[model samples]
Target: MPGERTKYAWRSHILAERALVGAAEHAREAAELATAIEPLAGADDVVCAYVPIRGEPGDLRMLDALCVRNATVLLPVTGEPGPLSWARYEGPDSLRKARFGLLEPTTATLPPDTVATATTVLVPALAVDLRGVRLGRGAGYYDRTLGAVGDGTRLIAVVRDNELVDRLPEEPHDRRMGWAVTPGGGLRELGHELPVSPE
Candidate 1:
Protein backbone atom coordinates (compact mmCIF):
# COMPACT_ATOMS: atom_id res chain seq x y z
CA MET A 1 0.00 0.00 0.00
CA PRO A 2 2.83 2.38 0.74
CA GLY A 3 4.50 1.66 -2.58
CA GLU A 4 1.20 2.21 -4.35
CA ARG A 5 0.73 5.48 -2.55
CA THR A 6 4.16 6.80 -3.53
CA LYS A 7 3.56 5.82 -7.11
CA TYR A 8 0.32 7.77 -7.21
CA ALA A 9 1.92 10.94 -5.87
CA TRP A 10 4.77 10.83 -8.31
CA ARG A 11 2.45 10.09 -11.19
CA SER A 12 0.10 12.87 -10.26
CA HIS A 13 2.88 15.43 -10.10
CA ILE A 14 4.27 14.44 -13.45
CA LEU A 15 0.90 14.35 -15.13
CA ALA A 16 -0.16 17.65 -13.69
CA GLU A 17 2.98 19.41 -14.89
CA ARG A 18 2.51 17.94 -18.32
CA ALA A 19 -1.09 19.06 -18.36
CA LEU A 20 -0.03 22.57 -17.43
CA VAL A 21 2.53 22.60 -20.18
CA GLY A 22 -0.02 21.52 -22.76
CA ALA A 23 -2.73 23.93 -21.71
CA ALA A 24 -1.80 27.24 -23.22
CA GLU A 25 -5.21 28.58 -22.32
CA HIS A 26 -4.80 28.16 -18.57
CA ALA A 27 -3.97 31.76 -17.64
CA ARG A 28 -7.09 33.23 -19.17
CA GLU A 29 -9.27 30.36 -18.10
CA ALA A 30 -8.26 30.61 -14.46
CA ALA A 31 -8.95 34.35 -14.34
CA GLU A 32 -12.41 33.99 -15.83
CA LEU A 33 -13.29 31.10 -13.53
CA ALA A 34 -12.06 32.91 -10.44
CA THR A 35 -13.90 36.06 -11.50
CA ALA A 36 -17.19 34.18 -11.64
CA ILE A 37 -16.67 32.72 -8.18
CA GLU A 38 -15.71 36.04 -6.57
CA PRO A 39 -19.20 37.42 -6.04
CA LEU A 40 -20.75 34.08 -5.12
CA ALA A 41 -18.36 34.13 -2.20
CA GLY A 42 -19.17 36.66 0.54
CA ALA A 43 -17.07 39.79 1.14
CA ASP A 44 -16.12 38.45 4.53
CA ASP A 45 -14.71 35.46 2.73
CA VAL A 46 -11.04 36.44 2.59
CA VAL A 47 -9.18 34.60 -0.17
CA CYS A 48 -5.66 33.38 0.56
CA ALA A 49 -3.19 33.07 -2.32
CA TYR A 50 0.55 32.67 -2.63
CA VAL A 51 3.24 34.39 -4.62
CA PRO A 52 4.45 31.76 -7.06
CA ILE A 53 7.98 30.51 -7.14
CA ARG A 54 9.59 27.92 -9.44
CA GLY A 55 6.82 28.26 -12.00
CA GLU A 56 4.32 26.35 -9.91
CA PRO A 57 0.61 27.15 -10.33
CA GLY A 58 0.85 30.31 -12.45
CA ASP A 59 -1.86 32.09 -10.46
CA LEU A 60 -0.42 35.55 -11.03
CA ARG A 61 -2.80 36.05 -13.94
CA MET A 62 -5.81 35.43 -11.78
CA LEU A 63 -4.09 37.09 -8.85
CA ASP A 64 -3.88 40.32 -10.78
CA ALA A 65 -7.52 39.88 -11.73
CA LEU A 66 -8.45 39.61 -8.07
CA CYS A 67 -6.45 42.76 -7.32
CA VAL A 68 -8.08 44.68 -10.19
CA ARG A 69 -11.48 43.96 -8.69
CA ASN A 70 -10.08 45.46 -5.47
CA ALA A 71 -10.85 42.29 -3.60
CA THR A 72 -9.22 41.57 -0.28
CA VAL A 73 -6.62 39.03 -1.33
CA LEU A 74 -4.48 37.38 1.32
CA LEU A 75 -0.95 36.21 0.64
CA PRO A 76 0.87 33.68 2.78
CA VAL A 77 3.96 35.00 4.50
CA THR A 78 6.10 32.25 5.95
CA GLY A 79 6.86 32.56 9.61
CA GLU A 80 9.08 29.52 9.87
CA PRO A 81 8.85 26.48 7.61
CA GLY A 82 5.67 25.03 9.13
CA PRO A 83 3.57 28.07 9.95
CA LEU A 84 2.38 31.08 7.93
CA SER A 85 1.34 34.66 8.50
CA TRP A 86 -1.13 36.49 6.27
CA ALA A 87 -1.12 40.05 4.87
CA ARG A 88 -4.06 41.84 3.32
CA TYR A 89 -3.21 42.33 -0.33
CA GLU A 90 -3.23 46.06 -0.86
CA GLY A 91 -1.99 45.92 -4.42
CA PRO A 92 0.86 44.55 -6.45
CA ASP A 93 2.43 47.90 -5.66
CA SER A 94 2.06 47.37 -1.94
CA LEU A 95 4.06 44.17 -2.09
CA ARG A 96 7.71 44.43 -1.14
CA LYS A 97 10.39 41.78 -1.24
CA ALA A 98 10.35 39.56 1.79
CA ARG A 99 11.92 36.42 3.23
CA PHE A 100 11.39 32.96 1.68
CA GLY A 101 11.01 34.42 -1.80
CA LEU A 102 7.54 35.91 -1.05
CA LEU A 103 5.76 39.25 -1.20
CA GLU A 104 4.16 40.97 1.76
CA PRO A 105 2.02 44.04 2.30
CA THR A 106 3.89 47.24 3.03
CA THR A 107 1.48 48.73 5.57
CA ALA A 108 -0.34 45.92 7.32
CA THR A 109 2.18 43.39 8.55
CA LEU A 110 -0.44 40.98 9.80
CA PRO A 111 0.30 37.84 11.69
CA PRO A 112 -1.27 34.40 11.30
CA ASP A 113 -4.37 35.82 12.97
CA THR A 114 -5.59 37.05 9.57
CA VAL A 115 -5.82 33.55 8.19
CA ALA A 116 -8.18 32.74 11.01
CA THR A 117 -10.82 34.75 9.17
CA ALA A 118 -10.31 33.31 5.69
CA THR A 119 -13.53 32.31 3.92
CA THR A 120 -11.51 30.64 1.20
CA VAL A 121 -7.85 29.69 1.07
CA LEU A 122 -6.09 28.97 -2.20
CA VAL A 123 -3.27 26.55 -1.76
CA PRO A 124 -0.52 25.08 -3.92
CA ALA A 125 0.15 21.38 -3.90
CA LEU A 126 1.99 18.87 -6.01
CA ALA A 127 -1.00 16.54 -5.87
CA VAL A 128 -4.37 16.25 -4.18
CA ASP A 129 -6.35 13.05 -3.80
CA LEU A 130 -10.13 12.64 -3.91
CA ARG A 131 -10.21 12.66 -0.14
CA GLY A 132 -8.83 16.25 -0.26
CA VAL A 133 -5.41 15.26 1.09
CA ARG A 134 -2.84 17.69 -0.32
CA LEU A 135 0.86 17.19 -1.04
CA GLY A 136 2.67 20.47 -0.64
CA ARG A 137 6.36 21.09 -1.21
CA GLY A 138 7.01 18.96 1.91
CA ALA A 139 5.93 21.78 4.19
CA GLY A 140 3.24 21.61 6.90
CA TYR A 141 2.62 25.36 6.91
CA TYR A 142 -0.85 25.18 5.38
CA ASP A 143 -1.75 22.24 7.56
CA ARG A 144 -0.90 24.32 10.58
CA THR A 145 -2.56 27.43 9.15
CA LEU A 146 -5.70 25.71 7.92
CA GLY A 147 -6.30 24.63 11.47
CA ALA A 148 -6.51 28.33 12.32
CA VAL A 149 -9.12 29.22 9.72
CA GLY A 150 -12.41 30.42 11.21
CA ASP A 151 -15.50 28.38 10.49
CA GLY A 152 -17.30 28.62 7.07
CA THR A 153 -14.03 29.08 5.23
CA ARG A 154 -13.66 26.77 2.26
CA LEU A 155 -10.07 25.70 1.84
CA ILE A 156 -9.43 25.15 -1.85
CA ALA A 157 -6.29 23.84 -3.49
CA VAL A 158 -5.36 24.92 -6.99
CA VAL A 159 -3.57 22.35 -9.08
CA ARG A 160 -3.26 21.38 -12.67
CA ASP A 161 -6.13 19.12 -13.72
CA ASN A 162 -4.06 15.95 -13.74
CA GLU A 163 -2.97 16.60 -10.16
CA LEU A 164 -6.43 15.60 -8.96
CA VAL A 165 -6.00 11.89 -8.38
CA ASP A 166 -7.80 8.90 -6.95
CA ARG A 167 -5.54 8.97 -3.90
CA LEU A 168 -2.31 10.27 -2.44
CA PRO A 169 -0.13 9.65 0.59
CA GLU A 170 -1.64 11.39 3.57
CA GLU A 171 0.41 12.43 6.55
CA PRO A 172 -1.34 13.23 9.81
CA HIS A 173 -0.19 16.84 9.42
CA ASP A 174 -1.40 17.22 5.86
CA ARG A 175 -4.36 19.55 5.41
CA ARG A 176 -7.51 18.75 3.45
CA MET A 177 -9.28 20.95 0.97
CA GLY A 178 -12.93 21.03 -0.13
CA TRP A 179 -12.43 22.07 -3.75
CA ALA A 180 -9.64 21.95 -6.34
CA VAL A 181 -9.42 24.37 -9.28
CA THR A 182 -7.59 23.90 -12.55
CA PRO A 183 -7.21 26.02 -15.64
CA GLY A 184 -9.79 25.52 -18.39
CA GLY A 185 -11.59 23.05 -16.14
CA GLY A 186 -14.36 23.95 -13.74
CA LEU A 187 -14.29 23.43 -9.99
CA ARG A 188 -14.38 19.96 -8.44
CA GLU A 189 -15.34 19.34 -4.85
CA LEU A 190 -12.78 16.89 -3.57
CA GLY A 191 -14.75 16.31 -0.40
CA HIS A 192 -17.43 17.79 1.80
CA GLU A 193 -16.70 21.51 2.08
CA LEU A 194 -15.74 22.21 5.67
CA PRO A 195 -17.99 24.36 7.83
CA VAL A 196 -16.32 27.71 8.59
CA SER A 197 -17.25 30.74 10.73
CA PRO A 198 -17.35 34.35 9.64
CA GLU A 199 -15.15 36.82 11.46
Candidate 2:
Protein backbone atom coordinates (compact mmCIF):
# COMPACT_ATOMS: atom_id res chain seq x y z
CA MET A 1 0.00 0.00 0.00
CA PRO A 2 2.89 2.35 0.68
CA GLY A 3 4.24 1.77 -2.79
CA GLU A 4 0.81 2.37 -4.28
CA ARG A 5 0.47 5.54 -2.28
CA THR A 6 3.79 6.75 -3.53
CA LYS A 7 2.75 6.03 -7.09
CA TYR A 8 -0.44 8.01 -6.65
CA ALA A 9 1.46 10.79 -4.96
CA TRP A 10 3.89 11.00 -7.83
CA ARG A 11 1.09 11.25 -10.35
CA SER A 12 -0.48 14.03 -8.33
CA HIS A 13 1.76 16.58 -10.01
CA ILE A 14 0.03 16.12 -13.32
CA LEU A 15 -3.43 15.61 -11.87
CA ALA A 16 -3.12 18.74 -9.75
CA GLU A 17 -1.85 20.64 -12.74
CA ARG A 18 -5.00 19.84 -14.63
CA ALA A 19 -7.02 20.89 -11.65
CA LEU A 20 -5.24 24.21 -11.41
CA VAL A 21 -5.43 25.00 -15.11
CA GLY A 22 -9.12 24.09 -15.22
CA ALA A 23 -9.83 26.21 -12.21
CA ALA A 24 -7.81 29.22 -13.19
CA GLU A 25 -10.72 31.36 -12.10
CA HIS A 26 -10.40 29.98 -8.61
CA ALA A 27 -6.74 31.03 -8.58
CA ARG A 28 -7.87 34.61 -9.03
CA GLU A 29 -10.50 34.15 -6.39
CA ALA A 30 -7.90 32.69 -4.04
CA ALA A 31 -5.70 35.71 -4.66
CA GLU A 32 -8.55 38.03 -3.70
CA LEU A 33 -9.32 35.80 -0.75
CA ALA A 34 -5.72 36.12 0.40
CA THR A 35 -5.93 39.90 0.29
CA ALA A 36 -9.15 39.81 2.28
CA ILE A 37 -8.04 37.22 4.80
CA GLU A 38 -4.74 38.96 5.46
CA PRO A 39 -5.29 42.66 5.11
CA LEU A 40 -1.70 43.07 6.23
CA ALA A 41 -0.66 41.79 2.79
CA GLY A 42 -1.95 45.04 1.37
CA ALA A 43 0.47 46.99 3.49
CA ASP A 44 4.00 47.90 2.50
CA ASP A 45 5.32 44.92 4.43
CA VAL A 46 7.20 42.12 2.68
CA VAL A 47 5.71 38.71 1.86
CA CYS A 48 7.72 35.75 0.50
CA ALA A 49 6.36 33.79 -2.48
CA TYR A 50 7.79 31.05 -4.68
CA VAL A 51 8.17 31.31 -8.41
CA PRO A 52 5.82 28.43 -9.01
CA ILE A 53 7.57 25.58 -10.82
CA ARG A 54 4.97 22.90 -11.36
CA GLY A 55 1.19 23.22 -11.18
CA GLU A 56 1.27 23.52 -7.42
CA PRO A 57 -1.14 26.48 -7.24
CA GLY A 58 -1.23 30.29 -7.39
CA ASP A 59 2.17 31.32 -8.75
CA LEU A 60 2.38 34.67 -10.46
CA ARG A 61 -1.13 35.62 -9.46
CA MET A 62 -0.21 35.58 -5.80
CA LEU A 63 3.06 37.44 -6.31
CA ASP A 64 1.51 39.96 -8.70
CA ALA A 65 -1.39 40.58 -6.36
CA LEU A 66 0.96 41.23 -3.48
CA CYS A 67 3.10 43.58 -5.53
CA VAL A 68 0.10 45.36 -7.03
CA ARG A 69 -1.18 45.99 -3.53
CA ASN A 70 2.09 47.79 -2.73
CA ALA A 71 3.53 44.99 -0.66
CA THR A 72 7.22 44.16 -0.99
CA VAL A 73 7.71 40.65 -2.39
CA LEU A 74 10.62 38.44 -1.39
CA LEU A 75 11.57 35.27 -3.27
CA PRO A 76 13.81 32.48 -2.04
CA VAL A 77 17.15 31.67 -3.59
CA THR A 78 17.37 27.88 -3.28
CA GLY A 79 20.53 27.01 -1.46
CA GLU A 80 21.51 23.84 0.37
CA PRO A 81 18.83 21.85 2.20
CA GLY A 82 19.10 24.09 5.21
CA PRO A 83 17.53 27.47 6.06
CA LEU A 84 16.49 29.66 3.14
CA SER A 85 17.62 33.17 2.27
CA TRP A 86 15.48 35.94 0.78
CA ALA A 87 16.17 38.23 -2.16
CA ARG A 88 14.14 41.28 -3.16
CA TYR A 89 11.82 40.73 -6.13
CA GLU A 90 12.09 43.65 -8.53
CA GLY A 91 8.93 43.10 -10.49
CA PRO A 92 8.84 40.66 -13.44
CA ASP A 93 12.07 41.89 -14.94
CA SER A 94 14.17 40.35 -12.17
CA LEU A 95 13.20 36.75 -12.90
CA ARG A 96 15.61 34.37 -14.71
CA LYS A 97 15.61 30.77 -15.80
CA ALA A 98 16.55 28.22 -13.19
CA ARG A 99 16.42 24.57 -12.31
CA PHE A 100 13.14 22.69 -11.75
CA GLY A 101 11.34 25.13 -14.04
CA LEU A 102 11.55 27.78 -11.34
CA LEU A 103 12.58 31.43 -11.47
CA GLU A 104 15.45 32.92 -9.49
CA PRO A 105 16.26 36.36 -8.12
CA THR A 106 18.44 38.34 -10.51
CA THR A 107 17.93 41.93 -9.45
CA ALA A 108 18.39 42.38 -5.73
CA THR A 109 19.61 40.31 -2.83
CA LEU A 110 18.68 40.76 0.82
CA PRO A 111 20.34 39.62 3.97
CA PRO A 112 19.15 36.63 5.97
CA ASP A 113 17.89 38.97 8.68
CA THR A 114 15.60 40.73 6.22
CA VAL A 115 14.09 37.42 5.13
CA ALA A 116 13.52 36.59 8.77
CA THR A 117 11.40 39.72 8.96
CA ALA A 118 8.82 38.33 6.51
CA THR A 119 5.30 38.23 7.87
CA THR A 120 3.95 35.67 5.42
CA VAL A 121 5.36 32.74 3.44
CA LEU A 122 3.53 31.17 0.49
CA VAL A 123 4.80 27.60 0.51
CA PRO A 124 4.21 25.07 -2.25
CA ALA A 125 2.81 21.74 -1.17
CA LEU A 126 1.64 18.49 -2.73
CA ALA A 127 -1.09 17.50 -0.29
CA VAL A 128 -1.77 19.06 3.09
CA ASP A 129 -3.56 17.10 5.77
CA LEU A 130 -6.04 18.50 8.26
CA ARG A 131 -3.37 18.06 10.93
CA GLY A 132 -1.28 20.76 9.16
CA VAL A 133 1.29 18.31 7.80
CA ARG A 134 2.35 19.42 4.36
CA LEU A 135 3.62 16.92 1.73
CA GLY A 136 5.84 19.00 -0.48
CA ARG A 137 7.56 18.15 -3.80
CA GLY A 138 9.91 15.79 -1.97
CA ALA A 139 12.61 18.45 -1.94
CA GLY A 140 12.36 19.27 1.77
CA TYR A 141 13.01 22.91 0.90
CA TYR A 142 10.01 24.18 2.84
CA ASP A 143 10.66 21.95 5.80
CA ARG A 144 14.03 23.63 6.16
CA THR A 145 12.74 27.14 5.54
CA LEU A 146 9.75 27.02 7.88
CA GLY A 147 12.02 27.69 10.81
CA ALA A 148 13.66 30.57 8.96
CA VAL A 149 10.48 32.61 9.45
CA GLY A 150 11.59 33.26 13.02
CA ASP A 151 8.80 33.62 15.58
CA GLY A 152 5.15 34.54 15.05
CA THR A 153 5.38 33.87 11.34
CA ARG A 154 2.58 32.62 9.14
CA LEU A 155 3.25 29.99 6.47
CA ILE A 156 0.41 29.46 4.05
CA ALA A 157 0.37 26.33 1.90
CA VAL A 158 -0.77 27.00 -1.65
CA VAL A 159 -2.37 24.03 -3.37
CA ARG A 160 -5.44 22.91 -5.30
CA ASP A 161 -8.76 22.21 -3.61
CA ASN A 162 -8.53 18.43 -3.62
CA GLU A 163 -4.92 18.58 -2.55
CA LEU A 164 -5.99 19.54 0.96
CA VAL A 165 -7.10 16.15 2.11
CA ASP A 166 -8.04 14.68 5.46
CA ARG A 167 -4.59 13.14 5.84
CA LEU A 168 -1.19 12.66 4.33
CA PRO A 169 1.59 10.15 5.01
CA GLU A 170 3.88 11.90 7.44
CA GLU A 171 7.58 11.77 8.09
CA PRO A 172 9.32 12.98 11.22
CA HIS A 173 11.04 15.95 9.62
CA ASP A 174 7.94 17.14 7.79
CA ARG A 175 6.65 20.61 8.73
CA ARG A 176 3.07 21.76 9.18
CA MET A 177 1.20 24.63 7.62
CA GLY A 178 -0.42 27.40 9.61
CA TRP A 179 -3.01 28.07 6.90
CA ALA A 180 -4.00 26.78 3.47
CA VAL A 181 -5.24 28.56 0.32
CA THR A 182 -7.15 27.06 -2.61
CA PRO A 183 -9.25 28.29 -5.53
CA GLY A 184 -12.68 26.63 -5.22
CA GLY A 185 -12.81 27.37 -1.50
CA GLY A 186 -11.45 30.39 0.35
CA LEU A 187 -8.84 29.98 3.03
CA ARG A 188 -8.76 27.39 5.80
CA GLU A 189 -6.82 27.36 9.04
CA LEU A 190 -4.75 24.34 10.06
CA GLY A 191 -3.47 26.06 13.16
CA HIS A 192 -4.04 23.26 15.66
CA GLU A 193 -2.30 19.92 15.61
CA LEU A 194 -4.34 16.98 14.38
CA PRO A 195 -3.38 13.32 14.10
CA VAL A 196 -2.52 11.92 10.68
CA SER A 197 -5.11 9.09 10.98
CA PRO A 198 -2.77 6.41 9.74
CA GLU A 199 -4.18 4.34 6.92
Candidate 3:
Protein backbone atom coordinates (compact mmCIF):
# COMPACT_ATOMS: atom_id res chain seq x y z
CA MET A 1 0.00 0.00 0.00
CA PRO A 2 2.82 2.40 0.80
CA GLY A 3 4.50 1.69 -2.51
CA GLU A 4 1.26 2.14 -4.39
CA ARG A 5 0.72 5.51 -2.67
CA THR A 6 4.24 6.59 -3.57
CA LYS A 7 3.71 5.50 -7.17
CA TYR A 8 0.49 7.46 -7.35
CA ALA A 9 2.20 10.59 -6.12
CA TRP A 10 5.00 10.19 -8.62
CA ARG A 11 2.56 9.63 -11.47
CA SER A 12 0.68 12.80 -10.60
CA HIS A 13 3.86 14.84 -10.42
CA ILE A 14 5.32 13.49 -13.65
CA LEU A 15 2.10 13.89 -15.62
CA ALA A 16 1.76 17.49 -14.50
CA GLU A 17 5.22 18.15 -15.84
CA ARG A 18 4.50 16.37 -19.13
CA ALA A 19 1.45 18.55 -19.65
CA LEU A 20 3.74 21.57 -19.91
CA VAL A 21 5.53 20.34 -23.02
CA GLY A 22 4.59 22.12 -26.26
CA ALA A 23 3.11 20.45 -29.33
CA ALA A 24 6.20 21.23 -31.39
CA GLU A 25 8.38 19.54 -28.82
CA HIS A 26 6.18 16.47 -28.76
CA ALA A 27 6.35 16.16 -32.55
CA ARG A 28 10.09 16.49 -32.55
CA GLU A 29 10.47 13.97 -29.79
CA ALA A 30 8.19 11.57 -31.56
CA ALA A 31 10.34 11.74 -34.65
CA GLU A 32 13.49 11.25 -32.65
CA LEU A 33 11.96 8.31 -30.85
CA ALA A 34 10.99 6.69 -34.11
CA THR A 35 14.57 6.94 -35.28
CA ALA A 36 15.91 5.76 -31.93
CA ILE A 37 13.76 2.64 -31.82
CA GLU A 38 14.10 1.49 -35.41
CA PRO A 39 17.52 0.03 -34.81
CA LEU A 40 16.07 -2.25 -32.19
CA ALA A 41 13.70 -3.73 -34.76
CA GLY A 42 14.54 -6.12 -37.57
CA ALA A 43 12.74 -7.85 -40.38
CA ASP A 44 10.05 -10.21 -39.12
CA ASP A 45 10.87 -9.29 -35.53
CA VAL A 46 7.82 -9.33 -33.36
CA VAL A 47 7.54 -6.06 -31.46
CA CYS A 48 4.83 -5.41 -28.93
CA ALA A 49 4.10 -1.66 -28.70
CA TYR A 50 1.30 0.60 -27.55
CA VAL A 51 -0.53 3.46 -29.24
CA PRO A 52 -0.03 6.75 -27.47
CA ILE A 53 -2.96 8.68 -26.14
CA ARG A 54 -3.34 11.86 -24.09
CA GLY A 55 0.18 13.27 -23.69
CA GLU A 56 2.01 9.99 -23.48
CA PRO A 57 5.34 10.31 -25.27
CA GLY A 58 6.30 8.71 -28.58
CA ASP A 59 3.21 8.42 -30.70
CA LEU A 60 2.22 5.44 -32.81
CA ARG A 61 4.75 6.72 -35.30
CA MET A 62 7.21 4.59 -33.40
CA LEU A 63 5.11 1.57 -34.26
CA ASP A 64 4.86 2.72 -37.85
CA ALA A 65 8.59 3.00 -38.03
CA LEU A 66 8.97 -0.51 -36.77
CA CYS A 67 6.41 -1.65 -39.28
CA VAL A 68 8.47 -0.11 -42.06
CA ARG A 69 11.26 -2.45 -41.10
CA ASN A 70 8.93 -5.38 -41.84
CA ALA A 71 8.60 -6.16 -38.18
CA THR A 72 5.41 -7.86 -37.08
CA VAL A 73 3.96 -5.12 -34.90
CA LEU A 74 1.36 -6.03 -32.33
CA LEU A 75 -0.65 -3.54 -30.27
CA PRO A 76 -2.53 -4.05 -27.06
CA VAL A 77 -6.18 -4.97 -27.19
CA THR A 78 -7.73 -3.72 -23.95
CA GLY A 79 -9.49 -6.34 -21.87
CA GLU A 80 -9.78 -7.04 -18.17
CA PRO A 81 -7.07 -5.74 -15.85
CA GLY A 82 -4.45 -8.37 -16.44
CA PRO A 83 -2.06 -9.56 -19.14
CA LEU A 84 -3.23 -7.80 -22.31
CA SER A 85 -4.44 -9.60 -25.40
CA TRP A 86 -2.84 -8.41 -28.66
CA ALA A 87 -3.81 -7.91 -32.30
CA ARG A 88 -1.84 -7.33 -35.42
CA TYR A 89 -1.20 -3.64 -36.06
CA GLU A 90 -2.70 -3.40 -39.51
CA GLY A 91 -1.81 0.30 -39.63
CA PRO A 92 -3.35 3.61 -38.60
CA ASP A 93 -6.51 2.61 -40.47
CA SER A 94 -7.11 -0.45 -38.29
CA LEU A 95 -7.10 1.22 -34.88
CA ARG A 96 -10.40 1.69 -33.11
CA LYS A 97 -11.04 3.64 -29.96
CA ALA A 98 -11.32 1.46 -26.90
CA ARG A 99 -12.03 2.12 -23.25
CA PHE A 100 -10.13 4.83 -21.35
CA GLY A 101 -9.30 6.65 -24.63
CA LEU A 102 -6.98 3.88 -25.69
CA LEU A 103 -6.64 2.82 -29.34
CA GLU A 104 -6.54 -0.90 -30.11
CA PRO A 105 -6.25 -2.96 -33.24
CA THR A 106 -9.44 -4.00 -34.93
CA THR A 107 -7.86 -7.23 -36.17
CA ALA A 108 -8.26 -10.69 -34.72
CA THR A 109 -7.19 -10.91 -31.10
CA LEU A 110 -4.14 -12.86 -30.03
CA PRO A 111 -3.77 -14.60 -26.70
CA PRO A 112 -2.51 -12.60 -23.70
CA ASP A 113 0.57 -14.75 -23.63
CA THR A 114 1.37 -13.65 -27.20
CA VAL A 115 3.86 -11.23 -25.71
CA ALA A 116 6.18 -14.15 -25.15
CA THR A 117 6.60 -14.27 -28.93
CA ALA A 118 8.01 -10.77 -29.16
CA THR A 119 11.72 -10.16 -29.25
CA THR A 120 11.18 -6.65 -27.95
CA VAL A 121 8.37 -5.15 -25.94
CA LEU A 122 7.88 -1.37 -25.85
CA VAL A 123 5.70 -0.19 -23.01
CA PRO A 124 4.27 3.18 -22.04
CA ALA A 125 5.60 4.74 -18.86
CA LEU A 126 5.09 7.86 -16.81
CA ALA A 127 8.67 7.59 -15.70
CA VAL A 128 11.51 5.11 -15.37
CA ASP A 129 14.47 5.09 -13.02
CA LEU A 130 18.09 4.53 -14.00
CA ARG A 131 17.76 1.09 -12.48
CA GLY A 132 14.91 0.13 -14.92
CA VAL A 133 11.94 0.38 -12.54
CA ARG A 134 9.01 1.79 -14.55
CA LEU A 135 6.02 3.76 -13.32
CA GLY A 136 2.89 3.21 -15.35
CA ARG A 137 -0.51 4.93 -15.15
CA GLY A 138 -1.63 2.83 -12.12
CA ALA A 139 -3.27 0.19 -14.29
CA GLY A 140 -1.72 -3.25 -13.73
CA TYR A 141 -1.92 -4.31 -17.39
CA TYR A 142 1.78 -4.14 -18.08
CA ASP A 143 2.83 -5.61 -14.77
CA ARG A 144 0.70 -8.63 -15.55
CA THR A 145 1.66 -8.83 -19.23
CA LEU A 146 5.36 -8.57 -18.54
CA GLY A 147 5.19 -11.57 -16.30
CA ALA A 148 4.65 -13.71 -19.38
CA VAL A 149 7.52 -12.33 -21.43
CA GLY A 150 10.28 -14.69 -22.47
CA ASP A 151 13.56 -14.57 -20.59
CA GLY A 152 15.33 -13.09 -23.62
CA THR A 153 12.70 -10.49 -24.36
CA ARG A 154 14.10 -6.99 -24.37
CA LEU A 155 11.65 -5.02 -22.23
CA ILE A 156 12.05 -1.37 -23.15
CA ALA A 157 10.10 1.42 -21.50
CA VAL A 158 9.10 4.21 -23.88
CA VAL A 159 9.19 7.66 -22.33
CA ARG A 160 10.18 11.26 -23.01
CA ASP A 161 13.65 12.44 -22.12
CA ASN A 162 12.31 14.09 -18.97
CA GLU A 163 10.45 10.99 -17.84
CA LEU A 164 13.64 9.08 -17.13
CA VAL A 165 14.23 9.85 -13.45
CA ASP A 166 16.99 9.25 -10.97
CA ARG A 167 14.77 6.86 -9.05
CA LEU A 168 11.20 5.63 -8.99
CA PRO A 169 8.98 3.93 -6.45
CA GLU A 170 8.95 0.20 -7.13
CA GLU A 171 7.14 -2.88 -5.81
CA PRO A 172 7.87 -6.59 -5.71
CA HIS A 173 5.48 -7.28 -8.59
CA ASP A 174 6.95 -4.48 -10.70
CA ARG A 175 9.09 -5.86 -13.52
CA ARG A 176 12.42 -4.24 -14.33
CA MET A 177 12.99 -2.88 -17.84
CA GLY A 178 16.14 -3.81 -19.71
CA TRP A 179 16.32 -0.58 -21.72
CA ALA A 180 14.71 2.82 -22.18
CA VAL A 181 14.14 4.51 -25.56
CA THR A 182 14.15 8.27 -25.20
CA PRO A 183 13.94 10.93 -27.89
CA GLY A 184 17.27 12.66 -27.66
CA GLY A 185 19.07 9.90 -25.77
CA GLY A 186 18.13 6.98 -28.04
CA LEU A 187 18.21 3.57 -26.33
CA ARG A 188 20.08 3.22 -23.10
CA GLU A 189 20.50 -0.02 -21.20
CA LEU A 190 19.17 0.24 -17.68
CA GLY A 191 21.62 0.38 -14.74
CA HIS A 192 24.51 0.30 -17.20
CA GLU A 193 24.08 3.41 -19.33
CA LEU A 194 25.58 6.62 -18.00
CA PRO A 195 23.11 8.91 -16.31
CA VAL A 196 21.23 11.38 -18.46
CA SER A 197 21.75 15.02 -17.55
CA PRO A 198 18.69 16.61 -15.94
CA GLU A 199 19.45 19.95 -17.52
Best by TM-score: 3
The Cα RMSD in angstroms, rounded to one decimal, for candidate 2 relative to the true structure is: 3.9
- Clashes (N, CA, C under 3 Å) per candidate: 6, 0, 0
How do the residues 1-199 of candidate 1 rate in per-residue lDDT, one tens digit apiece?
Answer: 2326574557565655655553456555556556644543444446788766544555566566666655678887766665687777766787788876776777655777788766678787777777898877655677777888765777777776666777676677666888887654556788743455598
Residue-wise lDDT of candidate 3 within 89-150, one digit each (tens)?
Answer: 98899999999999998999999989999999998999888889999988898999999998
Local distance difference test values of all predictions, in order: 0.68, 0.69, 0.88
Candidate 2 on 1-199: residue-level lDDT in tens?
Answer: 1323652564565365555465566556556645543554867577888776555556566677777778888898766566667787877788988766778889666655565777887787776767787777667666776766665777778777767776666778876788888766657888565555689
Cα deviation of 180, candidate 3, in Å? 0.3
Candidate achieving higher TM-score, 2 or 3: 3
Say which prediction, candidate 2 or candidate 3, comes out ahead on lDDT: 3
Weakest lDDT window of 10 consecutive positions for candidate 1: 36-45
How many angstroms is residue 194 displaced in model 2 relative to the true structure, after the best TM-score fit?
6.3
> Whole-model lDDT, candidate 1?
0.68
CA lDDT, candidate 1, residue 134? 82
Measure candidate 3: CA RMSD.
Answer: 4.1
Pairwise lDDT winner, candidates 1 and 3: 3
TM-score of each: 0.78, 0.78, 0.92
Best prediction by lDDT: 3
lDDT ranking from best to worst?
Answer: 3, 2, 1
